[model samples]
Target: MKHALIFRVVLGLILSSCLSSCGMAFRSEWKKAPVTSGVEGKWQGTWLSDENGHHGELRCVVAAPISRKLAVQKFFYHATWKTILSGSYEAMHTVQKQKDGTYTFKGEHKMPDWAGGLYHYEGTIKGDEFKANYKCAMDHGTYVMKRVR
Candidate 1:
C-alpha cells in the first residue's frame, strides 16, 4: 500500500511539474514586446567603425512582404579594415524579428572575423535612426543606425 501510494504521489508530482511549464511554452503571443512600431520599412544606411576604417551601405526591410520575422536585406561595401583588402564586399542578410522588438541578422561573408557569425541586435528605434547593440560570435560593436529608405 505504501509503495502504491508513493508511486501515485510521484506520478502526480511529475504531472504537476509538466503542467506548470506547459503554460510557459514559447509563443509569439508571449513575446517580450508587441506593437510593431519603429524599425519597420525600407532602410538605407551606412556602417562605420573605429576598429578599422570601412564604409558600407545597407538596405533593409522589416516586417517583410511575405513573411513574419523575416528581414530582407542587402549590403555592399569597401572594407579597408579587413585582414585582406581588395574588391568591394557584398552580402545578403536576413533579419528576423523577435517578440521583444529586437532582431537577429545573419549572413555569410568574409569581412572582419569579429563581424561574422550569428549576430544579434537589441534595438532602440527612434525617428529614422536605430541604435543597436550588435553582437557577433567573437566581438561586440555599437551601431548608430540611420534610415534612408
Candidate 2:
C-alpha cells in the first residue's frame, strides 16, 4: 500500500510538470501573436469570485477571429489561487460588435462535474477594458482585464 501511494504521488507530480511546461510554451506563442483592432491580444487582470470572495491574478491571450463572418474568438486563460495553485484552460466565445462601439460575447465550456460541470460566460469589451461574468455549478465570478499594450 505504501509503495502504491508513493507511485501515485510521483505520477501526479510528473503530470503536473508536463502541463505546466505546455502552458509556458503556449504563453510564448501568445506573446508572438499579432495584436489586432479586435479583442485579440495579451491581457492581464484579476478574477474575483462573487460567491466566496476568493480572488486571484489572471492572465489571458485572446486570439483573433478566423473570419469576420464567424466572429468566434479563442480565449486562453491562466488563473492563480491563493498565490499558489493555478490552472489554465481555453474558451471560445462568439463576439458581436454593437453600434455603440463595444463588443459583447457569450460562451460555455464543459468541465468535470467535480469542478463545475458546464461554465457559462457573458462579457463585453470596450476599448482596452475586458469585463466578464462567469457562472457554473460550483462558483460564479467576474473577470476584469486590460489589454496589454
Best by TM-score: 2
Best by lDDT: 2
Residue-level lDDT tens digits of model 1 in 1-106: 5456435434543454355442232222123322344545544454554333344443333442334445645433222223322223334556565686565555
Cα lDDT of model 2 by residue, 25-117, tens digit? 557756796766668888889999897687899988888885679898888888776676666778889999999999999999986565557
Poorest 10 consecutive residues by lDDT, candidate 1:
77-86
- Give per-candidate clash totals: 1, 0
Q: What residue pairs clash in candidate 2, if any at all?
A: none
Q: Given candidate 2, what's the lDDT at residue 149?
A: 77
| Candidate 2 segments whose C-alpha is farther than 4 A from its true place | 1-22
Off by over 4 Å in 1: 1-37, 64-115
Q: Give the TM-score of candidate 2.
A: 0.83
RMSD of 2: 5.5
Residue-level error in angstroms, candidate 2, position 15: 6.5
Q: What root-mean-square deviation over C-alphas does model 1 reach?
A: 20.2
